[model samples]
Target: MIVKYTKPGRNLIMVPMLILLTGVSSCASRPPSSVLQPVRLVQNESEKITLLAITNRDRESDGKGFGSRWAAKLTYEKYRFSIPSERKSTAIVYPSKNPDPRRQFVVTARKQLLDSELIDDATSAANFDGTVAVFVHGYNYSYQEALFRTAQMAADASTLSPPILFSWPSAASVTGYVTDRDAALYSRGELERLLGALAKDSRVKRIVLFGHSMGGFLSMEAAAQLKLQGRRDVMAKLQIVLAAPDIDVDVFRSQLRDLGHMQTPITLLVSKTDRALTISSVIGGERPRIGRLDIDDPMIR
Candidate 1:
């Protein structure tokens, strides 16, 4: 009886309902999922092979160029038993190339990658001293930033000697965090290679490696690789210093364990005020490692 009373409007309602049903059915009949999209894996190979020649205008301004030459000459004269006048004469002939201001000190540090001589020179210096300090930079740092940081650290720490900078191409863009991380990882193998080469020189006293932010992870990875190679003696020469490392504390600890009783002392410089590392911790979905412990924390101690 109700159906008989139903008007044309009621029939029209069914038309709209049918249309909706058809639409839904069409949508449902389509592929259940989007086609798997291929993701491009960015390789940090570009940064790995890079070598940057460091030159600074400020070195001249600060008289570091003159001082370095003087130091070199003085050492050559006193230690090598050569005449100071002869060494000074040679230094004058070389004059350290006026400390090339255009030469990149930090950003595109890979320029030296092609130069075996430069790498050899660095390695030679490290081996000669029996100790070397390698500095790695964090995210968003330019070549200048690396150079300035290295210089500052070298100047500040009297015991921190023979500063060598392993500059990775950071892109130095805040938005390029992923790229920067990839680059840091990419260059890790190179760092390992460098350390391995240095280790061959028994003359090397110790290797003090300093890394800030992502550099910390790279340093850890490099050290771990060195340890795994049965070169614990080389690892013994490694003193790893991490400053506001952008790494999961757990992961970092695991890396340390992998290093397995390195004679090299590990030190971390963490400050709760480190804003960059704090953001990294949040993105990584973990507690801020820097805030979780101080230098004297039992976990670290």
Candidate 2:
């Protein structure tokens, strides 16, 4: 006769069984699309736009150093801009000894667009007829990468009359995350200076500020600073668009509230499948803030 073996207690068996089931189910299911895809912005519609881009020089150099020079090499290929070799002395003047050369380059590009009269100027409220789109790029982007992205946006939103970019120092480096954060803070003053200059132009009626990844945090800070300085008057002239911002959802909302409840309409472009943001979240020891929550989240709402 065979002897009957005694069974383990329910509590011990249940937990292990559940875990095994969960593991099997997870293995059976496909991973989320965002897990497999890269993060990118989608531009559609709107016309007569100006782009302001904030770039990270340190990021560009890092790509070069690491021999992954995709940002530097592929910048111009993706966007249409007059290369230095193709540029005339009258077309644009390069900055000399600027603290942030990337920013200077972006400014120079904007000036070229303005000088060419390819896009209208925002000089008065009555002159506001088109869109002014400003882009603040995220971490680890090189100078060329930023330029190309700006150009690509311009091309994608060809209907926008004049696009301007606002470039900020990102100090793009993997190990320099802290330094980059500090740098972004340091550049707030410059952003404020730029906003002051833009607000004086009455022609700027419909302004769109687009900030991506970490750039979103910097953009929000800059906007808040502008509001505190009574520069909120410019809010009447603009719309704010944030894409995959790297700040905490709560922080973003609080800042908006402090800025007079976001006097202007705000749009957030979000993608849950952004690997970069995922990595950012992990490093920061926080949950990822995806675009899906932009509407329902109380903080952003």
**In candidate 1, how many Å is residue 33 off?**
48
Error of 1 at 123 (Å): 6.8
Candidate 2's C-alpha runs over 4 A off are: 1-130, 287-301
The runs of at least 3 residues in candidate 1 whose Cα sits more than 4 Å from the true structure, single-residue gaps closed, are 1-116, 123-128, 158-161, 290-292, 295-301
lDDT of 1: 0.47
lDDT of 1 by residue, 58-113 (tens): 12244222111111111100000001122211111111122222221112121223
Question: Which 10-residue window in model 2 sums to the lowest lDDT?
Answer: 16-25
Positional deviation of residue 234's Cα in model 1 after best superposition, in angstroms: 2.3
**Alpha-carbon local distance difference test for all models:** 0.47, 0.46
Give the best candidate by lDDT: 1
lDDT of 2 by residue, 142-220 (tens): 4444444554445444433435555555444555455656766766776666555566565555666766667778888
Estimate TM-scores for all models: 0.57, 0.58
